[model samples]
Target: MDLDQLRTFDRIVRDQSFTKAAAYLNITQATASMRIRALEQLLGVTLFVRGRTVTLTDQGMTFLPYARRIIGTAQEGREALRRVERGRVSIASLRTLVSPLITESLIRFQEHYPSVDVVVREGRQGQIAAMLHEREVEMGILCWPNIDPLVVDLEPLVIMRERVPLVVAADVAARLSSRPEIAEVLALVPRVIALRWWQADPETAAALVRLAKTSVELPTGPARRLAIKGEGLGFFVNSAIADDVKAGRLVEIAPVDFEPLHRDTAMVVRSLAALERPMLADFIREIALECAKMGEIIDDRLDKVVPRKPWPKPAIPHP
Candidate 1:
């Protein structure tokens, strides 16, 4: 018999009245009677005796426990499905942002949600955007200033604004006098190590192209390593170079003519509603916290190398 028929039979036995059971089930009394009749017909046995006081037949007594077990098992199965759905979160991010930016946050998230299954995949922004659009991933972490039309449907939650700094080995810094002009420094160092496909900021791109006669293109990790060995100057996220700068392995170089380059890094989702899941929401929160700490590290490093200067006011400012 169907679940409804079995449930109706159990309710009738529990309540001891079809009328009361129907009221509790939010169905008419006649409907409840029909369900009981249908269940008895399926089993080819009488389930109840009708009189001034209704009572279970021998067959009904034999079947009550089985029917209860069936309903309970079905409920357990549904709950298991819900648990599976709630216990997993999937994310994709740019390969470069994962190390210094998300590594600690992911560790904290795993500690907090020990049972949750978190999968993080790394790719370029375009690849991650495609994953999000195709539903291969629920969320993504990408560098900002992205204008891909594929991400038009996604919702962005900015985690932090990252300073893009030009850094060199300690020896390179020592060669240039304190706070030297950008052009003078560029004249000395004619080659720069940079990412091959990073074109987020046109000003930074133009500056590097103008100063450096030769460009060494590599991935983030290798570029940093090569820059550390004094192969060439490096342009990198401030957080990525924070440890090296603090430890005197690298030094930040101040660009005189151009304003400091910055890019926003964000956690993006297919929809705002995806954050409603507790696991996803908690993970995003942890990322935000970690990014805040990264910002502090960048600021502390910048304070040491870049001099504090007030912004120049606009000549025409009435708006």
Candidate 2:
């Protein structure tokens, strides 16, 4: 079917006047009439009544829905193809993963491909993996469950552990004459509960269950806010709350190591031969280089920080 004629027919139906349809289409009235006539002939039916006013005949009335649907589908097809050409890379990640590491890589990626549009969809670690597996997204950052399918390749980029610590408000941290140990803090303090999407994994979930107390479990942003406001201490990933720590709004209670959770994020994609075009392959290689640089940065930071050794603190009277 000639989409141009279908468009002409639809416009005539909308305007209810061949002259007006021609004006709207910016074509000569004769051309518009000829296109409409061709469409009607192709369907072997009269589409319009040529009276004082234009009105759809029975055939046109029946064909309206089909025409509209065809036009809509064609528009969507065009959009999808445009996305592919413009380097629209689809990615999913846990909200926590959008910290300095990932964003830094993205910045470099954008500089490399300014025309490429990036679509980032946030979900839990598992959800991100599922999107990659189903090919709903081009790539994703996921923890746990390794990529197993022969068609997909997983390139290990970096392993980062979020430092979950017991924190106190600035005022509260000052009140303590000495550093409080984890068990002591847990016993005396009505600590804020730390909730994270990363805790969905079995190992992390079990660790959180061990730390459960009379606590309010909230999402990462709100939970961090609640802790900052002096509403009891909670467990939080260091990367997620770096700004707060630097600004002195929150204090890390010493010796309360909740064990840094180690997770590896990799770039997963269909094998090189399977890629439809060079654009996607180019993106994958770019991402791999970015990931390597990110891993180096993370390693440098970790190397500088001295590891904390377990130390006992004097007991404080229960308030």
Candidate 3:
């Protein structure tokens, strides 16, 4: 039976008088009687026996507990929604953006709202675009300068930029002085694994491809790994390589011809209206804060981060 009918039956049973129950519920006795009649007809069993004092039939006693549980569960669900104690959020992001920036943002968000669950899927622009179009996720992060969303419905939430560094493994760095000319560095370009995120710069891409002894394309994570292992030299965003440079796993070499390059990163959502949701909005704030912090770190190291000035190499004896 419906909630109204179930509630009427419960009120009558609790008060043990149809007349009194009607007054408590603010309904006429005729209305209460009509509700019980409808509930009994739906169940195909009488719920009560009418006499000088009304009492439950065997069927009413059996159904009471189930009705109470249904009401309690509905109330609990409403309370959980209000508290956001069990909320969930999902997003699609560029795998390249998942370093100390996005990953650190995830940690910050969890620290603040531990009860909220977050899911992140990494993909290229087309794949993330598809995910948003299918309603699989409400947000996506894109590496910029070549960024244009595939879906018209998507809207930008945040955009961050940082310098790009040309890094080689520590062992590779030992072969050259701290500030090598572009031609000197090119002589050692044995392998290059590049991310195609910069489709806007075809001339530069052609030059890199032609200069490298062996050039191949790979995802950011794998490319970073290969660069760390001395397998190749790569151009990477400072955020992705900052720790590597500090840890001596990789070295940033200032090459004379390579211009001071920077990469822009953007976060987008399915719509501006999505930010109206409290949980989504908070997530955006956490991520933006992390990105801003990353920008500050990048800015502080701007001279060394870009090839504009000589990068001070950690002392490593010449090979």
- Supply the global lDDT for candidate 1: 0.75
- TM-score of model number 1: 0.63
Candidate 1 vs candidate 3, lDDT winner: 1
Predicted candidate 3 versus true structure: per-residue lDDT over 40-83, tens digit per residue: 99999898989988998899899889878887787778875665
Which residue pairs overlap in candidate 1's backbone? none
Sorted by TM-score (best first), the order is 2, 1, 3
Off by over 4 Å in 2: 1-18, 26-73, 86-88, 145-155, 183-191, 199-213, 255-264, 270-319
lDDT, candidate 2, 83-170, per-residue tens: 8776587767677766644566677556656677777788876576677667788766665335434334544333433445556678
Best by lDDT: 1
Residue 61, model 3: Cα distance from true site in angstroms = 45
Report the lDDT of model 2 for residue 317: 43
Reference-based lDDT, residue 304, model 3: 24
